[model samples]
Target chain A: MDRKKNISMAVIKRLPKYHRYLMELLKNDVDRISSKELSEKIGFTASQIRQDLNCFGDFGQQGYGYNVKELYNQISAILGLQKDYNYVIIGAGNLGQALANYTRFDKLGFNLKGIFDANPKLVGIRIRDIEIADIDEMENFLKSNPVDIGMLCVPQTSAQKVCDILVNGGVKGIWNFAPIDLTAPEDVIIENVHLSESLLTLVYLLNEGK
Target chain B: MDRKKNISMAVIKRLPKYHRYLMELLKNDVDRISSKELSEKIGFTASQIRQDLNCFGDFGQQGYGYNVKELYNQISAILGLQKDYNYVIIGAGNLGQALANYTRFDKLGFNLKGIFDANPKLVGIRIRDIEIADIDEMENFLKSNPVDIGMLCVPQTSAQKVCDILVNGGVKGIWNFAPIDLTAPEDVIIENVHLSESLLTLVYLLNEGK
Candidate 1:
């Protein structure tokens, strides 16, 4: 945790990429991995991987590289993937439903406790057997069934209001899909998933002939 | 184009964010903005904003700051948003449908040319007036109605195959939503949108008590 505070956000962002690669390696039954090998697979440079991992601790030996399974576990722990986290979707729109039905979350230990929406037409609909509750019921639902995270998929107009509801309802973190930038109290963590940003980045890259 | 080739990927990634903030300012009828003002609003440092903008050319005057509309247009051109690019979604699942129905793309000059699905039942279903075509017809469709980009929303198992088809069909860029690392030819730009990576980052922040 002390090491985490000292790490840069750039490095923190790459940890999950490392985790994903390590998971793939584990699935392939590879017990060992060199920085170069991992780098070739993930696109990040070998030196950058070493530097990022060193911020956490000396997980890799000088010559032995890294134990794939052990490193995977360590990275997972550092990423807070060891603990089971419950989350709820704030909007039952297309984005919200896609996220609710995203099968990977459950495999990653994130339990979808509920799915809520402001639209009367959407409320009560089941996405993967999880019923979409009314936005008005979010507070009560959160109180009775606490969740660590809230996935905000509401439109930009209603994002802040829905975010506020989640925060007040005791959600410690928010994964926002709305285009709007949101603000929250110091205690609440917010990670904005700007889909368009990725698309624009691709556009720039393509235009550059990369 | 020469300046773009020299710019770092990190800087390129933030271009869309700067564009977004500038758009917001424009919408509010704000005509002029300073790096300091933008920094405060967007969370990047004033110096960083200046540095980023300087990569393309001098857009900000020493004392006069920047013309909001002009700067926005400059950034948009740099992001290739100035040109109209047609894109086809290769998987008409929930994510694909959401992206196809995403109204913001058309505003950004990315026209939804088509949507395709391997599922026979899903094929021909209309999303936002654009019919979902059978994946088998993708090659034929791309031949007749060529698109600049292919948005891959298929499962991990089929991502690579779908991507190959897109490339063979002459698509220049790929915005992949599948949780797989896809490979493409040198001319084809690929941007993998790993949704779980963002979630894990949120989890890490939450557990760190941020």
Candidate 2:
């Protein structure tokens, strides 16, 4: 694989969309697809799709287009979906429990190692067959368990503190459900799934249509 | 407000981010901000921020920059946050319950009118003070209550069917949490918050860093 040193964030963001579309096609037994066909289905222009895919390596041929299975496999590898990543949810609240029970995580190779919370009443409770660990044991647990990602489902006030603990514990990635913005070192990657922000976007679009 | 006839989706996507940052500034008692200062905090370029803001209307002054409170209010109105939108959750699962209890929705102007489920066992249960209604009564509930948005937290198989009900019952927007890509008429808007896709993006980023 010819890895590009500096790929644009825009291209990186669109990769998952492309991967998802390809997965759907593969499920439908689509053996091959042209850029034009992909563009029609995925909403991105053919030229833009070609440029985005070319960032990694040439996966498409001129007349032959792309092999759906091979392309899907390549994208899966590129997305690191081929590897099983161990993750711990910092808060065993409603959102955290939802994520813990989310079946897709196992399908996508994200293994939920544990769920943790500060409340003693909630700790030791079982969610999706995993016992909620006490928050005090988080750092110790990280030392023993190889957790690649930390899912922050705590409140705004505790999010940053939890983030610091996660980073200090050698967690490389954070998927923050907290509303607040967290600052992390350059080495750590953070992706925020702000539910409110997404809802606001929908509201704006709905109003705009009117 | 001078609303542009054609606003790019990219620009529309950034509006919520700007609103979030401005809200933070307001909370911190920051009265004013320049485009450069806003860019530094929001990660968007100064020119890009200016261009995005300009799409709706000129909200900034030459040297005085912008009044944080005023800009925030303007953005709130532009994003339809000023109007209270009634929303109902289709599935009374963990994700749906989380959204119903999400405090930010009330703060932002999305009112949780009801939560519904097909399970007779789960129906009539109260989540966030809203009693879960039976899925059979969904059409009747929509008819009686003016619900602007339908939050789809159902499984992949039932997502499209629920979406159809929401649209046919006169819901304007559908905030889909289901993994499937749903199809709606041109008049109705749908925004998908695919959790697996988000996790895949994080995994890809974590791998890329290595």
Best by lDDT: 1
Among all candidates shown, the one with the greatest DockQ: 1
Q: Which whole-number lDDT from 0 to 100 does residue A91 have in model 1?
A: 85
Q: Which parts of model 2 have CA positions greater than 4 angstroms off? A: none
The lowest-lDDT stretch of 10 consecutive residues in candidate 1 chain B is: B1-10
Please give, for residues A72-186, the per-residue lDDT of candidate 1 as tens digits: 9999999988889999998888888889888899999989999988889998888888888898998888889979999999999999998998999898899999998898999
Q: Which tens-of-lDDT digit does each residue in B95-210 have in candidate 2?
A: 88888888888888778888999999899888877889899789888888899999999998899999999998999899999987789998888999988888888888898846
> lDDT tens digits, residues A36-106, model 2?
99999999999998988898898899988999999999989888888799999999888888999988788
DockQ of each: 0.76, 0.71
Query: RMSD in angstroms, candidate 1?
Result: 1.9
TM-score of 2: 0.94
Which lDDT values do the candidates have, in the order given?
0.89, 0.89
Worst 10 residues of 2 chain B by lDDT: B1-10
Q: Give the CAPRI class of candidate 2.
A: medium
Model 1, span B1-210: residue lDDT tens: 567777888898899999999999999999998888999999999999999998998898998889999999999988988789999998887888889888898899888988899999998788888888889989999889979999999999999999999999999899998888889888889998889998898898888843
